[model samples]
Target: MKRDIFLSELEILKGIAETLNEGTELKAVLGECLRKLLQLTSLEAGWIFLINQEGEYELVAAESLPPALTNPKHQALTQGDCWCVSRFRNGTLTKASNIMECKRLENARLGNWGDTYGLVYHATVPLKAGEEQFGLLNVAVANKEKFEAHELSILESIAYQIGTALKRIHLTMKEQDIKIVEERNRLARDLHDSVNQLLYSINVTSSAGIRLAKEQPIKEIMADIQRMSQHAQAEMKGLIWQLRPAGLEEGLACSVKKYGEMLGLEVDLSVEGISRLTTLQEETLWRIAQEAFHNALKHSGEHKVSVVLDYKQNTVVMTISDDGVGFDYAEGTFLPSMGLKGMEERVKCMDGKIIMNSKLGEGTTLKVELPIQQRGKC
Candidate 1:
């Protein structure tokens, strides 16, 4: 009857385990599990071991093994001396009634340490669920006493608790990795289509202009090439930086002013209330500005670039335009316009829209507007 009860309890544990599965974090569930398991089994002490990459068991959570033995200092096992370590790795739960006398534990990893080990009676089981195994859960007694069959069932159930919890942690980690990869891909495409193109134009044009200036008496040509060369280098640097995680303080106005000065572009940035926005909004604004400012300095035959940031009563708006000879806003320009599409996508992600106003003879104006989102402060 008790054996059937123990099996039913394990079944219940599997169902109620969804709580631990919801998160990869282990501290709360792990502590709760050990506390309940020790009480359930009436064991003198219970200790949980987590397998390291080196295939050694490290003490994670423990009760009654003393502070020193509960958190063992000599954890790493060498060679085939780890008999208990091998037992769990084979995907089976095992027990050694008397660790000092068990034949299977002869020459096992950490076996020699038993004489030095303060705890004597040991019950070891693999912490596993399905096919994946994490490590071993072991209980030890200072005195030489064997566990009854009922206590063994309790120990077995504890293993299942750890197994289910660990499985949840693994799933959470995998999902997190997926999200990171997706974010990286989106950002990479944005960089390639926008920043890469502008830098390419600068590099190509500057090289040609330099060659022409050398052959002919064209002082202005040489100056133009020199300027474009510097700006291209700056664009390359800026693009690489955007591919990385941006620091929270590095906003649109600050980055543009610093980068423009670094590349010798006389930039006037008028940013109002940029710092007050959420981190996501700030990042989106900063990236879009990077592309637009690149356009004004490199392609727009403009002397100065102006970037204005403003937040209205219920709207956030940013306007970046150049006093350059603006070209006709046609689908032809848009087709080859990687920068425009990237800017649009970024604004869309922020629940915003973009407007472009340009004339062949006059200058250009690019405006972005987003409704004030009810976002909680990070």
Candidate 2:
């Protein structure tokens, strides 16, 4: 009996591992895994939640939920707060254990919402990879008030596997995003180097032809050619700008200054020390600078902004400041707003640091520091 039980657990784990390894889409993977786990363990239901850094929890996967939880579009599970989630947000639920009772089920029973199928308790496990906590895995069985010790242990192991898989998927997605950005930049560079130069040469030659032509027809033809070339050149510039910032090849500072000017802002730009940055580093910095400039223009109530770029000790530092009105800046609360989260993600992808300071009625300042040596590491 012991050997059979061990083999059963092994088969369950092997099946789950294969499911996780073969999947890339997060919701689909979690749903399939939950289905398999519940079937193997004879549990009645399971669900998974993915919590972001902002303490927002999303119902990523669920399987075999009773009518009480699923009726009216999963209102019971998705809408209200539950004990496990509260504990998770408060940093109390760190391991797999039997929660005393399922709050949602109890509430359903009290409210006479629907049939719960005798589900009164659940096992909650924290999903984590190394030190990073992602979310929770919860499993419940009908008429079961508690889970066995070995059951909790197995759930813990499965949660760890799921967490690690989530980490891998996230990293893969990030890498793909980076590659897409790099490829777009490369295309922009090609257009600027080859097509843009050709258009410029055509415009110049047509202008010279108009100047030297003696016949009226010849001069008119040259003028028409010049106008067409100019229009095409402008369109090309717009396309390149969509792919990557203009003047970026000259330097990061130049690109940012030009962008600010285009946005109708008075940019006071200064540069110190020579910069040794990779293409990815330059791209990341330019993006962050653009976001800062945009925020200043929209929210700061000031037309003039200051930008400082400095390179020293193999690190590049940039500071963007606005003298207009600023809002209270709390790292935890404000990151998801004002496009700051996107900037933070870009910096993190490059293994860099970003800091922002702001206060009500005061101005805002954003600083970014990136190491030159971290280029290869990222």
Model 1: weakest 10-residue lDDT segment is 70-79
How well is each residue in 103-179 modelled by candidate 1, as lDDT tens digits? 32222325453442444447777777775566777666555456656656666666777787776665564456457
Error of 1 at 307 (Å): 48
lDDT (Cα, 0-100) at 17 in candidate 2: 94
Q: How far is 61's C-alpha from truth in model 1 (Å)? A: 3.6
Q: Write the per-residue lDDT of candidate 2 for residues 28-92, one digit (tens) a residue.
A: 88899998887776777889987654465778899988889888955888888888888898899
Estimate TM-scores for all models.
Answer: 0.45, 0.70
**Candidate 2 wrong stretches, greater than 4 Å:** 1-7, 246-254, 263-378
Best by lDDT: 2
Backbone collision tally, model 2: 0
Residue 306 in candidate 2 has what lDDT?
96
